[model samples]
Target chain A: MLNIGGLNQGVVIDHIKAGGAMKIYEYLNLEKQDCSVAIIKNAKSSKMGKKDIIKIEGPITVDLDMLGVLDPDLTLDIIEDGKITAKRNPRLPAQVTGIIRCKNPRCITSTEQELPHRFRLTNKEKGLYRCIYCEQAYKR
Target chain B: MKHVISPLDLSMEELDKVLSLAESILQDPEKYSECCHGKKLATLFYEPSTRTRLSFEAAMLNLGGSVLGFSSADSSSAAKGESVADTIRVVSSYADICAMRHPKEGAPYVASIHSGIPVINAGDGGHNHPTQTLTDLFTIKTLKGRLDHLTIGFCGDLKFGRTVHSLINAMVRYPGSRFILISPDELRIPTYLREEVLEAGNIPYQESKVLEDVMPKLDILYMTRVQKERFFNEEDYIRLKDSFILDAAKMQCAGKDMLVLHPLPRVNEIATEVDDDPRAVYFRQAQLGVYVRMALIMTLLGISAG
Candidate 1:
């Protein structure tokens, strides 16, 4: 077992698909964070066989739902007083704004810089998202 | 009170209201002629579509409203590098309502977000054309006497036909509306539509390469042009260009009451000889575009017939 220190108070993002921790790290903009963040890539797990995990030491605000979009099977654990306080599994959000950009070149967001790229989850089972403005489906 | 960005934006009840108002306008044109008196319609067409622009202008004029704005992007401030949001912010102040046709897919959506007045999407790339859908629905109801329980056949260029996609989305909301999709394999309907729309709605549909085979089963045969501009390869366009031509012989297989429709400026997909057929209703469909726009303008402006 690889030993890593437990966080005094922070969040631990677990069960990220192996090798996906770097993307989640970049997506969360952790590089610029003033606090400490440890990224573990391809850690052994009995359930997943191999997985990536991100641990942040200190209170921080992160959109878990976005992490769900990046990796639906991810689990989040909140640490308080060096003990696991809450365990949460992020589910697919019904609506997402400014997270995923509309890829359609003709989408108004491509030209109009002020509009936020918004999408609505039209099908949960298929993981389908449609642009709010153009209704163009996001290719999975 | 809302801008029409897609056919799905309007609920079935709201669609019925628009169609009912259109029917009333058809029966008593004079009663609604001056309903929009002293109002203004700004037509901000970023692309050249003579028929769509003219229909909107004529519709507003018939309702006693004045028309303003340019015919193409080169003539408008868009050519001066003004963004759609900024242009619409300025235009909405001058006009009571706005109708925009842009080559970019969601340009009208951006305009609607920034404008104060109701924005109507005349057409937008291969993405959406809500007014055309309204025109089609109005024509369907007018000719078939109902919008439900009809076997609608869509032929040619289903892959890029925004009108066909919008119409199918609208029709599936009604019960007993089956679709007969006829097109070359290269031009079949997109997979998202097949899955999200037909399959999700559990709407019964059949795909076929032969148009004549499905003609007899159709209550309405909607033909679309095989748009050359939509093709990436010229050879592919040339290969499938004549895949489904509705000639007089093909029409012989259709029912006497079957209505034939096309979103026009066609390129040989529909034979000229079919125009003389009693079942041909594309011309009447084009004319209905004007009345439907009138109804839409009135409804959007909250104007009621006298």
Candidate 2:
């Protein structure tokens, strides 16, 4: 029953898998920013055995599609004036650019550090993304 | 500019453009040496692929470009916990063009989206081997004098053989060509290939386990190793092992003009007796790889090697 008092307004990513809050924080780069964020871990849930919740103060831009990949089971709720204003369930992007690594060691992307890892969504339900360069598939 | 990611992305005209450029470079090597002057080509190989790396390096050196990149992932930044994206982002700054090899499927596809210059997939886990396909095409064009109406037999490991798959896909677009798949029961070509390439294209094909039985019918005998690693059981490897070997005895059954090609680093699959056979074209296949790559680099970089 960990609860942070309040926040001005922003997004509340709820129903995150337990202990995944820190990953979300790191992924979002919460510490380096000036905006305030409250992360609650090990919160009891009826659907999920245990979950984590994140409350962000201010309308921080987050790539929801990537969040879907990082934690597919997450529920994002935009809060305004202490009330849930909007709900979003963004699907994983059809093509991911500059995120995720190509696991193929033979692919040129594996060596070139300046290139962004790009993949096209080949199978959405399977979470499979194929590399445009190497045709390597990444499932998140 | 240096990397070749996919064959589908390259049109037929583009393929022809590359092939023609490669032809010119093959005809005149000294003229293209300064084409890549003061440029660097990096190859980051996460897998053990000596053939692809050597060809890439040879292509660059022949074009007056310097080559630098790791051949194994254990010696690279991947061991330092860096993602493939980060590595490419860094390397793109160092090299003008890059080639990569990885075990993970579609690794280069991911790299290409992020790559600043160009990313070439040397090979990904059983996914696609475009360069090898290009080399095979170039070899066929050079030796056979045409890309159409030839019957090619793919022997040995067809199940996980990327080169065989790519060649099959690329060749079907032409007229009068057919495939004779020779493999053990366990290493049969996948259904997707049958349904997608052969059936869809309505290309005639036959399946067999005996190489000698079908040798005379084939204009090109493309042999791939039935690798021991591909077998689940040791007994299976031992049992079907001798069936795929291309020795002098087997070559006797093949047509005199029937060229033998292999995407190689062969162990015992191709016997030493066959190497001296004038019909044996595996070494020539390897040599053609550089020319094909030269063609690919020139085409992708939007420059004619002329």
Candidate 3:
């Protein structure tokens, strides 16, 4: 079994749905950061059956609002002096801009390359999003 | 800075105000002829829509207001690669208000954000056409006499018809606006609308494959065209074709007072034989579009008839 070191002072993005760490890593642009990052995929979990975890070395600041859009069940644990300090469950945002592209063919964002693709949370319980331009549903 | 991007943009009160103003304008056109004399209306159409463009122009002219702006993207700087935001910002300074029709959905929304003047969504792709909705409501109020406690039967292509969806959304807010959706199985109203809108709102509705089955139950029969490609099988198309077309025979099933409407440039969804029926009001509906649009422009421009 391959092993990775625990974070001394950073964040442990826990309970990410299995196979979702890489997407979060890419979304956060972790490769561009100076700090070290370790991804644990298919980690044993009683609750999720299997979950992916991200342990970041050293303190890092990234807006977690977008992560809610990816996986609403995502949990964030802040590490300080090698001890867990705070935990957060980032929920879906009311409005998200430029994170997801509007794929509707008739959407203005499709032709207007400069327009920021904006979405509004029309149904929170269903985690449904609609394009501000076309009201087309966001498809995963 | 107000923009009418969707019918939902107007509150119930505001909608009543606009409809009331339209009724008044219809009752006495000469009294409100100069309501917008010093104002100007810009028709910024990114696509060619002669009917909607002329209706808007006619509305402004009816108000004694001058009209300007392009009828197509090729005639404007959009051909030179100018953005909607940029064009609207410039046009905003040139006109007091503007009605926009764009092939891309929400182009008017983009323009509205950068515009200094009120923007009316003439039509936006297959997304929204608020003025058409306003006109429908105005027609209902002026001719049928009320907006509530009525049965509206939507026929033909309910799936791709933007007007049907918008009118449903607008009417559902009223006290007893139920729907009798008539379309082929392939072109029924989308699930989200059927489940989320109608079912969720607890608005009573029934779906049927045949138009005549629901004709007698309707107070307003709204019709749209059905493309041939939408059928699942050729034989079913042959069998069910006449069921969707409103002919004199189908009109027989309708009530004597029931009104028939269509967003025109209509193909054969409505038989020309039925056009002479006293209840056939689609052409009059288009004419009311001008009055409704005039009222919309005035309401948005804050130019009261008083």
Candidate 4:
């Protein structure tokens, strides 16, 4: 049995798709954070079959919008005084700014270095996002 | 603070107002000659397009407004790596209104974000060219006498013709408007347009390769150039080039009142002989283009004629 230590006061991001923990970690800039982060990859689950999990031992504010684009299935739990405080299900933002880069070479955002890469959620069902300026569909 | 980044920027009612102003300008150019006496229009062209640039300058000149700004990126600070935001912020102080054309898609949109004055997108790469669409809408409403209830045929390169997509977008807003798209198999309208714009709007349409077959049914035959660069093979271009050409013979297949419209700089898609036809309104469309632009400038600047 693989055992992990419990968090005292922090966040437990659970139900992440298997192999997605590292991405969440990098996106959150966990390496720069002064908090302890534990990544559990490919953990067995009856619901998702295998999922990745991240436990942080300090206050952290994940960009819920970015998290939504990364993994909608993932659940977030906040702990305070060693007890679960709040649970969060990050939802996809209507307008996404400066997260995923628009890939169209003809897009103005491509040539302008300082322009924020902004996208609007066109289809929530398909998880479709389109560049606000160029109208180029954001492809995963 | 309004910016016309795309054709969809103007509502149908707003389109009517602009077109009405265009017709009035054409009726009596004197009434609106000095409407914008104190205003200035900045023509910011990031690419070389003498036609569009001259049209904008002419429009400003007609409105009694002085014009300024560079015609090419090399002449502008853009070549020196100045951002669109910074340029627009600076240009806003220099001019009351600005018409911009850029090779990059959505460049004007970026400018719109930073602009203190109204920003008109002249042409943005292969993206939005709202003014051209406005000009087209004006031509149709003036010549055809109505904005709706007509069968419009889009012939030639429907695939790469952003105008066709834009027109379809504009027309679908009107009632009882249907389309017949005539293009070669290799140059069909984009699938997203077919499904999203057409099907989503419940717009009735037909696709055909034979222009002759669709000509008689059309009230408006909108033609576009089929650039050789759009085709992958030389043989295909050679085979398809002559097929899409609008000649006197093809005009016989069309109705006497079937107005033909083409965004100009024609390269043999339209035979020179068809220029004599009263129905061939492309030159008139060009004239209307300037008038429409004058109206657009007036609308943007809020310069109503006294």
- Scored against the true structure, residue B287 in model 4 reaches a CA lDDT of 86
Candidate 2 segments whose C-alpha is farther than 4 A from its true place: A1-140, B1-3
Clashing pairs in 1: none
Off by over 4 Å in 4: A1-25, A30-60, A71-90
lDDT of 2 by residue, B1-306 (tens): 445666555678878878878888888889998788788888989877888999999998998889999988899988887777778899989987888888866667677767887887788777777888899999999888899999999999999888898899899878999899999999999886897579977899999999999999999999998889888899999999999999999999999899999998888899998899989999998998898887776666666554
| TM-score of candidate 4's A chain against the true A chain | 0.84
Indicate whether candidate 3 or candidate 4 has the larger DockQ: 3
lDDT of 3 by residue, B1-306 (tens): 578999899999999999999888988999888999989999998899999999999999999999999989999999999999999999988999999999999899998898999999999999999999998998888888899999999998999999999999999989989899999888899999888899999999998987877888999999999878878788878777778899999899999999999998888889999999999999999999999998889888888876
Docking quality class, candidate 2 = incorrect
Maximum-DockQ candidate: 3
Error of 4 at B150 (Å): 1.5
Q: Considering chain A alone, report the TM-score of candidate 3 relative to the true chain A.
A: 0.87
Candidate 3's C-alpha runs over 4 A off are A1-5, A42-51, A80-88, B231-239
TM-score of each: 0.92, 0.71, 0.93, 0.88
- On a 0 to 1 DockQ scale, where is model 2? 0.19
In model 1 chain A, which range of ten residues has the least summed lDDT? A63-72
Ten residues in sequence with the least summed lDDT for candidate 3 chain B: B233-242
RMSD of each: 2.4, 7.5, 2.2, 3.2
Question: Which stretches of candidate 1 lie above 4 Å from their native place?
Answer: A1-9, A42-51, A81-83, B228-239
lDDT of 1 by residue, A43-110 (tens): 99999999999999986777667777667688999899999999998778998888777889877777
What are the per-residue Cα lDDT tens digits for candidate 1 across B120-195?
9989888889999999999999988999899999999899888999999999999999999998887889998998
